[model samples]
Target: MALKKDLKQKMISEIDGNKNYISVEIELQYQPDLIHLLREEINYIGQRFYYKSKDYKLEMCGIGYLLEARYSHLEHDEIYEYWQNIKEQLNTMVFHEDKHHLKFFGGFQFSEHSLTNEWKDFGMSHFVLPKFMITKENGRCYLTYTDHSHKFDIDNIEEILNIVESKAQARTVSEPKMVANKDIQSEEWKALVTKVVALMNESVALQKVVLARRRKIEFQDNVDVEDALQRSLDSNEASYLLLFESGKSQFISQTPEQLCQIENGKLYTNAIAGTIARTEDESENNILKDELLNDSKNQFEHRYVVDSIIHDIQSFTKQLEYDKKPTILTNKHLYHLYTKIQADLLSENVLEIVNQLHPTPALGGFPKVEAIKFIEHEEFGTRGFYGSPLGYIDLENNGEFIVSIRSMLVKGKTATLYSGCGIVKDSNAISEFEETDLKFKPMLKALGVM
Candidate 1:
């Protein structure tokens, strides 16, 4: 209570004293579960974002709209330029750093021109400078607020603080419930995969294309986003659990693939492909792992990802390095072939590098432009933010992005789950269909459907 009062008084004093945008952060001694707090305190349908990494977590509520960028109906090449314009605006804004500072949280759609009206709230690309944010790192928690108007309302600040304190003290754990689930266009999706593989085998300029399917689940009562996120965090501790809410829809995922990360003048990312299921028996698990490593079809699928990433990033990187052999990354439900790539960055613009490397062979396909064309024309449903990049960029040019996979979009009682698998010349339609099913297990179990 004393800390809240002190923070309120300090915010009021700062706003009264400054003419420019005011940003303040106060460290809290006690740690609170971020998603639990969000579920209890956030009243608005949209204007919420949650991110959890292995070492750090951030939860943001409310939107001050200090700076926002949205673009629709833009070509692939033009999108990067639009982002540069937004970055220019962000560069001019004055920020006060206190070891911990606020960053823009958002992501781009899978395709700018292909985005449907259903995802109007997300736009082609969107990012927000949240009004209030809670960040936890290194065993400490901090609360931050940004006042773009330069006039703080002490009463509202007090209310927010009170809610935080109450939620921190009286946390309740919710139980998961089973839901009714249906696979949307199951047979059609399998047929599409078969066609794609046949085309690839016929040498139709498509070597490898990834196909996705959606599962719609309905619950008797309104689904709790926090509970769903908690389940993901508990199941996949090594992966990134993220949420982005816009209007009434929330996009959430627990992804193991990192799109890109730049730190200390170096760039790092991974090639994560070639999926196999994990078994309860150690011997069976080892057999599956070895099969994934030695399987020619899986290796061919994975090499495209590594080669495409390396080719795309070579322009901006001085020295690139990666392991010769990919090791197996095992989660609770599955195993993936993983290879780490590192390089010294030659360009300070990290977003530019991100643009070039996004939709790698793992997500899109080989011969990038042609594969995208086929996906746009052949895919049965909209990709929305699935298999796209989502993360934050700081003032220091250091950021991390994860490919949004093993994800779902929730609206009220209904949730739409998304999963995809890589298709190659030897890929069988039935096998690919089964692979997508395996991919769906993470989100399915998280939603209490499995």
Candidate 2:
């Protein structure tokens, strides 16, 4: 109570009429089950964003948007220009030493091309600063409130607290049952993979081109976001648990691939490709891991990823280092060839780094531009955000982004799951199809539809 009074008084004295926004934060001693709060489904808030790190160290849930930037078909430079304006407008009240809750969370579509009507709400690129957010990090919880005004309103602050305090009783909702499932263009996708492989064999420039497919599912009833998210969290703790909800659509995923993590001019990323499915037996899993490491095809696919990432970022990086051989990274249903890469950045321009490094050989293919062109022309439908860089960027330009694989887009009773695999000259269409099947299991299981 005293803290609230002090904050109100402080805002009154320090409010600058010229500024466009104000953000204030207070630490919460009481740790509420954030997932439970989400289960409450506060509809009036309109939109919500959720992110939990792969390591289980950071969890955040945000409600509504105090400010947001949404754009379609904008070039990378233009997107950064809007971000610069956002950075200027963001006014964070220095409440304490821990100033970590202020962040812009969202993502860009995989391509700038025209997408299907299902992706209408997501746009080409969208990011938001939540109106109210709860963050749990290193055993501490903080509630942050941001308003689209220079002057703070005590009534608004009080109301935000009241809304959070009025927690709903936990309910036991059964997972929605699956009614029908459709694999969109299964035979066509396999044929496309074979065609891409033939193109790779003919042209040395395009050694590898990643191919993707979509699966549309129908449920008996409307799926509960909380239920699906909770199941994903329980099952895929080793992967990034992420959700971006806007209006009637929600993009949710538990992805194991980390595209980039920038902090204090240091860049951390992983070259994650070369997939193999996991088995129930530990010895079988080990055998599969060894096979993945030595298999010429998988190794070739993984190398393209490592080489392309280094090629793209070498100019912007110093002392960049990664292993010559990739180790195994295991998730719920699959194992991936993983190579950790780190570098000291010549510049801390996050957007430029994202621009240069995204659509790497892992997702797009080797020889970046050519592979992307092939995907644009050949891919069945547009990839709105699947396989794109999806994560948050903080006010200081230090944040993490994970590749959006093992994901699904949910709208009412229908959900569309997405998965992809790298296609090389030696790749077999049937084998690649199986790999994507493994990838789809994570989201399928999450939705209780597998």
Candidate 3:
């Protein structure tokens, strides 16, 4: 409490005379599990964000909305332009860059146009610069706050400190309960996949389109976001685990696909298609890996992804390179044919490239527009944020986004899990159905349903 008081005094003094810039980071000794704290305590206050990769983690509790830009209807190019405008505004607002601090956190929906009422709150694209944040990186932790206005009140500062102290002291671990699980529209999803594949086989413009399904699970008690996140951390160490809470809806995922990452003037992305189930036996796993690499159907699906991504990014890249042959990337439940692609970025604006590469052949289909239209007409339900890019971008335009696959949206007792598979001419409806089931295993096991 004394340290927090001192920190508050420092901030007050900094902002007392000057109104343009006030940002501070106070080093803390104790490191708390941020997701646990968010779920257990801070969520009641305002919007909360939790992001974790292998080496870095950030948890943000919005003290107040510093700046927010949302659009319900906009073209992709227009959305990118609006975001650039927002970034320009953020650049002028002074914030302390204490190593791993996040200036903003939010995501874009899968589609530019709204599809259903379920994702109305999320809108088509939204990002928020929170007033308070805590970041843990490289075994160190810091508490940070930023305010660019003259209305910096001491009362709000004290409230934030109090909440932090309370959450730090009240840490308790609890187990998540396993409850009933129901697959929504099982037959309809399979039928849709069959229809799309049949069209592809008949020389339709769509060569490969990914189809998704939802599974609804009910828990005996209120679902704990922290508990599910812990399961994700335990099961998938190589994946990016994130949680974003807006009002009653909590979007969370442990995903392995990198939609795009721009850092130090280079662009990085991956082609993660062609999935195969993992086996407990090493020899069996090796055999499955070989089969996936050699299987014509899986290779064809993967080829479309590589080709589409290369074409999409060609305009913005000066020099591009990617692995000629994909390597096997294994998770707890499945393995994927993964190819790494790198390029020299022509512009500092990363969102432009992200807008183009999104819904790649891996997620949408071969011909981007046609595949999306087909999915829109054929799929049973709206894809809220599933298969979309979700991550943060800073004032310097350095950021990373992960494809929101193997994820779920939890509201109270009910949670909806999303999983999808790429469909091509040779794709079997039953096989695609089984592939989706395998894809669901990660989240299902995390939720204690398997």
Top model number, TM-score? 2
Clashing pairs in 1: none
lDDT tens per residue, model 2, 206-241: 888888899999988887778888888777558998
lDDT at position 180, candidate 3: 78
Whole-model lDDT per candidate: 0.76, 0.83, 0.75
Per-residue accuracy of model 3 over 1-450 as CA lDDT, tens digit each: 544566556555655433353455566676765655565554353376778864444433434456566667534465556556654433132223445354566777887544586666676777766667777766767666666657545565455555666654454455556567889999988888778878887896888888889999998887877778777776745788888776678888888888998988999998989988887899999899999999888888888899999999999897899999988888776888989999999987777777888888888988889889887877877788898888877656788888999899888888899999988888888988988888887787777766
Alpha carbon lDDT of residue 412, candidate 1? 82
Candidate 1 lowest-lDDT run of ten: 89-98
Candidate 2 error regions (>4 Å)? 1-18, 44-46, 166-168
Evaluation by lDDT, superior candidate among 2 and 3: 2
Residue pairs in collision within model 2: none
* Model 1 segments more than 4 A misplaced: 4-20, 55-67, 73-98, 154-157, 167-179
By lDDT, the best candidate is: 2
Q: TM-score of every model?
A: 0.90, 0.94, 0.89
What would the per-residue lDDT of candidate 1 be over residues 1-450, giving only the tens digit for each residue?
Answer: 544565555555545333444555677677766766687755645778888774445444433345555666433344444445544543122112346556667777787537665576786777766677777766666677666454544465445566667754454545555467799999999899888877887896989988888998888877788778877876745778888888778898988878998888999998998988888999999999999999998898888899999999998898899998899987777889999999999986666777888899899998899888988888988998999888877656677788999899888888888999989888888988888888888787677666
How many clashing residue pairs appear in each of the predictions shown?
A: 0, 0, 0
